[model samples]
Target: MKKIVLATSLLLLTVCSAQAQIASAYAGRLQSVLDSVGKRFHIKGLSAAVYRPGEGMWTGAYGESYSGVPITTDMYFPIGSNTKTYTSCIMLKLQEAGTLSLDDTIGKWLQNIPNVSGQITIRQMLNHTSGLFSYTNDPGFFTALNSDYTKVWQPEDMLQFIGAPDFAPGTSWEYSNTNYLLAGLIIKKIFNEPYDVTVRRMILDPQGFTNTIIYPAEKRGTIPHGWTVMTTNGPLEDMMVSANYDNTAFLSMATSAGAIVATAEDVAKFWVALMNGKIINSNSLAEMKQFVSINANNGYGLGLFRMRPVNGHVVYGHGGTCFGYLNENMVDSTNGITIAVLTNQDSIDNNQIFNWVVTALHKNTLQMAPLSIAGNEKADDIKIYPNPASNYVDVNLGTANNAKFELIDMTGRNIINTTVDGNYVRVSLSDITPGLYLARLSNTEKGILKTTKLQVVH
Candidate 1:
């Protein structure tokens, strides 16, 4: 018995070590890109974090937060358009309180809400489907952005350039600050509170996200500015420019659009909470996850962008960009991974690197975990009726004794899991949301499971 106990301890220790090694392996794999960037470019530093559901989590930071100070998991960075996700989340929280509806028109709140000859819903604003023209494209705006760069921008001033509708609202997916800016306004009118307060109360406090700052600079302190490379000879020339890196200040201009600062860890925490229904109720989250076709090329769901190809599992994410820092992050809810990639200098092809980082992380999950049941567990004949199972589905296991069953989301997180026997299993989905999920069947060893993606539509 003593020998057996010792062996059991050793086995548990081995398992723990292996899990840590897997987490470290993922970090090392992603950190390699940051390592390469340091050698290849004048990218002063890069930081990335990856979170796996019910597994290992780590935030890998390379180089400096500034010039010499080392960036840590706690240190903040300017998280550009990633702020849009925050803003979108805030909108959902307001929806939860019964103060507003996605269908509410902008005209209902702001008397001056631009009626660009087509009807646009509040939902479109959050999803970037609103046909409003982007003010950033206006030549005059850059002139403003370059001059007093941190000058407080007014909505009327922004609207002057944002004039006219780009397309009839909801006609397509075109990202515009105008959509989010109005989203802020709608929140303000309904909540009857300052935008910052609404953001803090609705999003930050609820998610235990203390580090997230909106309108971070009040001309309060020396803030990091977005530095861009003007030219690239054999030596790259960094244009020492300042665009308020303080979420407190820049976020004011970005309001509900783009601009917020947070550590990689906090970003991951926000995503994990949101995906798992910690920040918002499951019902609103379900609504937010609903796919709205953006165009032939893509689709948008609430505040998130759902990437759909004529292919594999769709991923949801948002990318961000500012001056000095070019950032991108993705959360595969189905797979339970969150990746945040950042670079301090824009001298490199940041876009390519960000895309590569996410792909590598995703590929790593696929490679590391060979998640398949063996022994020809074909269930072609084992029927699960009502493809989008509403409430109940008659699952015919058909002579498969002691079979293990599970209801899994796209990311492979098991939701409703159990083991049962006999010829048939009556699966009740009253608890599952109306979205795609697989009904998996398996046995203890040399197992087989059927992957039936079910949707519950009430």
Candidate 2:
């Protein structure tokens, strides 16, 4: 406990010193605001951790991990939907290994998955375009969630919603747990192993992430964490949620789906690992990043969520939920900011905190990409094919070489950074989340600047 407290205090000092160029009051108030958040939310024993770039690491616990005992920074939490992004990563890793194809139809891997069309590609499932039924919406989902919800759920057991199709694949997008469940099944079939094992082998083990978990049903008695009690009318109760359960129940999410646990720090590390080409083969991981539409979380990609704006830069991550708990986590890998929050509360302040933390972090983040076109060169030449692409994009520089190209979105952060050595440079824009982005190219030596639109519609 002394070591942990010392480490946390050092992180605070680091953040303060690193941000000295900015201001101390800014840092102090930011920390204060987090505590205020705990108080405002009636947050009991809540924990918040951040990994700021070029500064001190910050992690502190308030309230308790539960009402009875003290919660520390080292303790683990479910991290909810944050697990989905990892699930998506495993699928991409499999594709890179030639065990699966992003374009593979659902019927190709799982049994009795009624194919609305033979086009329900793995890409669509990860991007939530498969239009499958969201198992969370099933009343039976909640009914089972409360009583003996710890039973081990095989992939097929979770896929019982295959009786009808919600919409034609890729016609419209809807978040469906069935998609992830199928993804998990596909992983199992491809790797001849359990989904949890495959994910750890691919993402967790490679990155050395130790705090997250995928609850297994058989280990019910050992579960950690709590839930906030709330009625449909929303009353605050000093109750810990179902922290203990059979960890195996998490398997129901399938290998390619949403069953994993992690700390805010691990979430940050994984985002950076994925961005820095440390998780899987660079080419395949890039494919996983291609963004997709998820109306609920603003937008989605292969398996990520484009959460919000930070220093006018886009942030990426995912939020999650299970029976009695709500979880939300986010990361802006480019700028090195990560936020993870776990709650036993029946509901959470995902939107408010997302904005608050982003605002605080944005104020301290350096080199916030400026989205200015007033004086910049207007680019009319050069074209990049497959704008909303799933896997890759082809850039035609039109005789221009040795230039830098940037794929910038509304937040002004360039999602893709590449240098042109030939007339055409094919960049992998997948693996990242999906959304609208602009392609900017500049030859500072030649004093030439060109901008174009690039979309990855995978």
Candidate 3:
């Protein structure tokens, strides 16, 4: 019996090694996907990573961080609201240790902040149900933030910008940085140390996430120069180019709400580890996954959001933005594959680019071309007949079962969403307006079967 068990263990290790080796072979193509998407979007710098459970991880970077310097896989980017995941995890861990209860009202640990009541529960804060006003939305806060780029803001100082509560606590849901700001203060108060120190002790150090750190408070190494639009209709300006544009004040103000700097690879690994019971226990994870329905296709859990990119495929993750950076991390529920995409420029939609990267990574066959402008290249598994169709279009789902079809416009709006079976399916375009649309086929088993550009004509 012992010999059989040993042999089985050896066999499993061999299979995992082979799978990782196969995944590594796609490195060049993955790199191409980043390069193509980054250039198309005019991103100053971009970094992306993919983590498969049995297969090893892959990371890629593109474009220049500065005029002459290039973005590398090792460079850090502020993972804006993604920091909320860490903050939420800390609160859950504290509950597990009997340090605090989620049901406890904020009034117990904190008191007397204008517009914020003590009646808000810890769970409400973690899940953005507190109805607290988002301090960042206050025009005064922006004025102060712009007034002094070098000034490090205390959590309370930020709270002063809060005008009034959006609604009564637990009455409705609204995304507010103020909720997390108070949560960070509570963590600091409970641990008798800085909030980031608790984060380091609880999550970062245990996972060997050496590259990730709370920014401004911790010295950050040289990172890709991040860019942002300074005015409403302004061009992208490098945040690192001058002290006036420095990210220090913004990051400091972000605090626990959105102030962690780390590589795309580390961000991807963090998600996979959290979901697999490394950061928290199984029960805690289950609690985290208890989602509140936000819409037909999306839901919000504790710190994470359910992303139903297509029919039947759900990924749990978060997206974030800092002064000059936009980042997104998603882990596939079905396959346990994690993907993180980071870009320096804040103007473009990182989700559209992330969806393209996901489709590129899960190609059933290697014969497909690199990811390009939607609708130009066809995948080997699926084929869309006729270049332009006025009333109907036929899709051939080669070797794909239980697939769902989705048509999205250029603005990322869903035009048609439905499920289909068999090898051949016809979609009606009679209602669709004349223009370009991206037709995507996906299922639970395979993340993205195919994404092609389709043109609708009258």
Candidate 4:
């Protein structure tokens, strides 16, 4: 008995050692992918962080914050429109506390200059279905912005550029920063304080996000300078010194739309906490995720964007672009994975970098643990229906007992896996984004059985 116990303990230790080595190997591969992408894009600097359910968190930074400052995980970057997510979260929290209702109109909350009516609801504003014109689209707006980079802009001044509605309220979808500016106004009116004060008390302080700030004018010079090109192919220019990097002019007007700055790690942590239901109630979160289809594969939720990538997994988050910064934060809710990518230069292809990093991580996961069953059965006996599924798919394992199944993406990443209780097993595909997937079944005794393609549409 003593010899048997000693052998079992040794086996467990060996398994733990092997797992640690695999994790270390994957971390090295992830860093390599970041380095390659940063060099290819000629990004001034790039910072990213990832959090997996079981693996905890990992962060990487490449290139320079400025000419000589090496980018670090703790350095702040302007998250741009990602501030919409925070603004929307604040609204949902207010609704949960009975402070306000999503059905409330802008006219009810604050006085407006033009086209204000009861038809426009807070829900429509949050989801970009308000049909309001985007102030940023005006050519004269840019002309003025460039002419006087130091001129402070009030919310009403920005509103003057919104000449007309894009379409009837709630009749179409259009992204408009004006909607969020109004949302900020409503927040201030309700709390009887500045928008930033409420944001800090409700979100930053509660989350212990020490690195996240509202971009105060006094500390503008303390942050890393934003870089952008002056002409089509000109050399990089320092936007801060040029009076363009979150200057008082832009910050005063962009309050709720684009004026938040945070480190990559803090961004990832915020999403993780949000996903785990630590920040908002489950019902509020559900309301936030009520996605409105923007296109065949993209959707807009309250403050978040629901995207179905080529890999078929649904990602929830937002992307931001300011004068010289581009950033994105994505959360794979199904797998509890969060990724935050931030760059100091707007020229970088942020989408490519995000996709490459996720792909690398998923590929490493598959390599570390390849899914396989025991036996060697033929590959023609299993059936999956409906062939094109929307919500759920049923798998029929004929004449095979105790089978295991997996739903894989085109990239060969195992997205979902489970065991078959009897002849038929029902798998939930509701959380998955609309795309193509592969269903595979194998018996414990039969090794390999069958594979079939699946199409999901909603």
> TM-score of every model?
0.72, 0.70, 0.74, 0.73
lDDT of 4 by residue, 302-417 (tens): 98888777355667888887766778777764344677888766654447546655455444443443333234333346678898998999888766666767786653345777
- What does candidate 1's lDDT look like per residue over 73-188, in tens digits? 55566677777777778778778887788888776666654544335788878777778877666676656655654466643455655667788877777878788777776777
Candidate 4 vs. true structure, TM-score: 0.73
Of the candidates numbered 1 and 4, which has the greater lDDT value?
4
> Which of 2 and 4 is ahead in lDDT?
4
Candidate achieving the largest lDDT: 3
Q: Write the per-residue lDDT of candidate 3 for residues 174-273, one digit (tens) a residue.
A: 8888988999999989989987889999999999999898978887676677666555665556667743576778888989898899998899889978
Clashes of 4: 6
Candidate 2 ranges beyond 4 A from true positions: 1-30, 114-118, 217-224, 238-256, 294-297, 308-311, 356-416, 419-458
Tell me the lDDT of model 2 at 322.
52
State the lDDT of candidate 2 residue by residue for 103-172, as single tens digits: 8887687655553344678889888898777765566654554455456666666554454668888788
Candidate 3, which segments miss by more than 4 Å at Cα?
1-22, 231-233, 310-312, 356-458
Task: Look at candidate 1 and tell me the lDDT of residue 169.
Answer: 79
Which residue pairs in model 3 clash with each other?
A: 375-453
Candidate 3, run of 10 with poorest lDDT: 1-10
* Residue 185 local lDDT, model 2: 73
Relative to the unseen true structure, what is the C-alpha lDDT of residue 318 in candidate 3, on a scale of 0 to 100?
85
The RMSD (Cα, Å) of candidate 3 is 14.5
